[model samples]
Target: MQKTERLVAITVLLQARGKMTAQRLSNILGVSTRTIYRDIITLSLAHVPVSMEYGPGGGYYLPDDYHLESAIFTREEAISLILSADISGNHNLFAGDTDLHHALVKLEAVLPEEYRIDVMAAREHILVDTSAWCNKTQEPTHLETIRAAVLNSYQLDVLFSDTSCCQVHPGAGMLWRRIEPHGLVFKGLSRRHARVGRWYLVAFCQRCRSFHTLRVSDIEQVYVHEETITPRPNFDLHDYWREARKQLEKLKPPIIFKLHVKAVARYSTLHGDVTILKEEPDGSAIVQVNAESMDDAISYALGLGADATVLDPPHVRMAVAQTAQAITKIYS
Candidate 1:
């Protein structure tokens, strides 16, 4: 590894642990012990708090309060960091507000003149129109506290808002919930919409004895306990999510209905998953969809606007007619 890379690697290693021997650093960095010593001195000169111990099993250590400064990142690294920070929802994972901001400033300072202009231009011109359903912002501190509790295998007293009701409630709402913090999953598409881009903590809920989806937004507060819980044996998060998706899909009845839609092109393109049974030359399309009930199917057809005409089971057409009558009554 290059001297610069080795320096960064050493810093990472020290942060993960408190100390590393010269031999271990050499082996990890694929360099000679002498080179490692040289790099350590260089880092020390750069204000990296590096300490050396001398003994039979001596090694190098960084002080508990040691931190990397802004000079560590090159211009390219700085730009990447800024872009990442702009999109990162959990900014609190990094220590200190000033640390992240200072890093961003350093990155901007070193950005290539042309690249900086291009980035500014892209930001100015790009317009992202998100849908109304978007996820809410989660407080970084709350998420971190919950994560720490999960990591330490401790139970948490959480103040949570139940989605079933629109009010916030406080207490040790869910108790003695042993959780093995598996991971966090980002769900939804858009960040701007209230229900879009929400984050969920995916953990094994000991109280329910099942996997529970807790929205980050619903978590009002988290209090960590001293207890720990053992993780499920051979728990595969990937398979768990796959099965979860399937179960959710099964809950929604299949869309099955027949529609003679006038805007054939528009309807087919939008509801292509619903089989197109036939088509007419006058720009009309005959489509069939399998749904759990007539009400559900008709409601879906209505969403297609005036372009759609239901030609299915008699009961479904009658339901649609009744809906139209109800609308006419209100208007008239």
Candidate 2:
């Protein structure tokens, strides 16, 4: 690794546990003890607060509260950071002080003059069409609390709003669920179709008497429970979600539909699924998939908008028409 990269790595290692010997750092960085000392001085010159101790327990340490004020990046590194931030920004995932905009500002401030222009040019031209789905107001804080509980392997007593019914009773509506959070899954598509962009916290709900997928937004309040639920030894998050998706699919009646999608080269490159049935001579492709019910299939087609068309199962076309009429009645 380059000296600058090594410096960043060293800082991260020291910060992780707050202390490390020069010899240990030297071994980890594949440099000599003398090189480690020189790098420490270099870091200090760059305004990093590093302290050194002597004797048997001697080592280098950053104060517990020290924070990284700046970072060094190559042009490529800068672009990657900006693009990642841009993508996340599109998702409405960064609405607060901790968002991508802040990170970009810091990066631009510290970036070398030679690479600044390229970074700015890339930022100016790169565009991400995030889904229109907006995050729930309390999502960030709620996610953090749930994450902490999950990491600590603690049970959660959560007040949840069940959305299965059309109208909810005001006073007696709240349900308390004891959940053992397993993992988080960002399911469905973009934010615009937010009902589709459901962020689920997969958990074993004791009250439900089975595993459940709880929407993050549906959680009203959470209290960390005193008990910790032990996860099964063979539990794997990836396998769990795969099974969940399949089970969900099974619950819906199978509706076969075909779509002729006018695949935009640029857009397709980013979001297209090649695993679907067919690709045409032109850039356009035919897609074949099964939805739970006719209504579900029609909704999926509508989400694709004019870019796709229903080419099979003539009944699906009627179903789509009826759904459109029903939706239009609301506005009418």
Candidate 3:
């Protein structure tokens, strides 16, 4: 029996039978007393509210008010439901954050042994976050249609409006294009420092004869084809995205600068624009500011006022100092 299954079984038994001793639970579940004790600890961590009574009638029992609506699920069914909830999270159409999270926990606590390891591994690799920068929901228009097309392996006739495309096709606003929807990804430039992101469709463009990552937001219209298409062979979304980001980084690398910011301003300094490298005893931090250019970097540091100072890239520091002196002259 897997740990999760055993934990769920223990929970059910305690809730139904009431006041089960460790030895009894161990014998019933075909596990050791030591294992039962550990399982009890795990249940507590998952917030099951299991309590123990001491002395002659000593045994573990759940509070009278605590109740779990139990359902028997096949191994595959449980795994799928758990992983789906894990990936989608409380964002998107599934907006019940608290309820869905707890439901996932309960479902995961009952997965059978054969499917447990694989499910856990899959969870680590797949994540779908639909949150925008300021804790706001940033869902794209026509996201539902695009998502359905990707899942069903359908071709799409899309009206795309890209500012960059305007140079090539002057006066052309929204271009009509056909594509085979390969996958959907929600990501930003630097995965580590990316707090803000938009949904992008990784599709094989029929006109371009190449795979293009099109911003879903920029897609003005979407028409799903009646006929479904087979998925492209040997196509891996993760691998494709990795190579695409590499090429993009080569074209324009991030402009990085060092900053020494007071703790009070640290929250404002971060704001998804910087990554902290170290923290000091005086409640200050050394952070690396990432931007598109030196001007952008200088502007960010200056915005922090006296709470932040540029430490490296002497030229940048000089520029920031000059800007500050000019501002001081205006006030004086």
Candidate 4:
């Protein structure tokens, strides 16, 4: 690569990979260690925060706060970036990052007129909404407070939504639980899906003496504390979420329901959690499904009309029968 490209590459590598030795940079850029050192000096002359450490784990690194002033992107890359910014729930994901907003505006201003038109056309064809259907999306009231506490390694005094009524009773500190904020988990989808994005505060609850995934919206009140606490040893957000989901599945096992399906065409409407046990000669099928409760099973059966019947689980079948009879009486 040319010297100018090599210099830019070095800057990007340091910024992306955090730290690298001269030998590693030389090996990556197919250049000599001397050339790598010269490139580092050139970047330093350009006011890049390139620093080095001398020790067993020493390497060349940019400061933690160092950021590139500007970036160059190809046509495809620019389109991808602009579309990502456009469809990121209109700044909902970033939680009102003014820097990001300004950066995007700058990027748009620099794009050529032709490229700008192409990007706008692409946006018109493709739209992504990350919210759940039926208006189930929840916005946390104490998101900023929890976010600050997590960033500063501070404890949070939280009142969970476990009371008898909708209002908090203004109880003593006995009711407020203290937690060491570990991280925040935003669970949501990108496509047109049913699962809406919900913010969850993962923390070590001192009262329970265990890790808890507290829903942000359900937190009635939160107070950030001056007392900072270190995170748990080797705490990983993705690993904790995976293990927590496994335990949750164990706690709430799927309720199986056996069903006799009549109209095969309507079978496509069934939920994804289904298993066909047997198929009859009359195009009927016996299937098993998982529901949360008997009421869910009844509703599922009723939705199919005469196309399906809840066979096993006597109570669900009885409930479906009673509901059908009541509906028939109303029609008569």
Q: Which candidate has the top score in TM-score?
A: 4
Alpha carbon lDDT at 259, candidate 2: 74
lDDT of each: 0.59, 0.66, 0.72, 0.70
Q: After superposition, how far is residue 158 of candidate 2 from its true place, in Å?
A: 2.9
Instruction: State the lDDT of candidate 1 residue by residue for 1-332, as single tens digits.
Output: 35665576576566555667865565344455677789888988888888888885577887787655546856454445455445443433332324434435444555567657765765576544322335434444476676555444566655554331223223434433345555555555312133345466666655456666566667766767676556464554556666765764576555455778776544453442467677678767787766545566656666676777788777787788788788889999
| Candidate 3 C-alpha lDDT tens digits along 1-332 | 56765676687678667887876676455555678899999888878899999887789999998875334445665566666556556554324225435645765665666667878777788676655555665578788788767655688999987443444466777788788887677665432223446677888877656787787889999999977755465666667888876765686676778999998998644554577799999989999878766666767788788899899879889989998899899999
Candidate 2, 219-289: lDDT as tens digits: 88999986877656456566778898787666654676777778773244323222367778777877776
- Model 4, residue pairs in steric clash: none
Question: Which pairs of residues have clashing backbones in candidate 2?
Answer: 131-191, 131-192, 132-191, 132-192, 133-191, 133-192, 253-292
Regions more than 4 Å wrong, model 3 = 1-88, 92-135, 161-173, 188-195, 266-286, 292-306, 310-332
Question: Which pairs of residues collide in model 3?
Answer: none
lDDT, residue 307, candidate 4? 82
lDDT winner among the candidates?
Answer: 3
lDDT of 1 at 99: 40
* Count of clashes, each model: 15, 7, 0, 0
Return the TM-score for each candidate structure.
0.47, 0.53, 0.51, 0.58
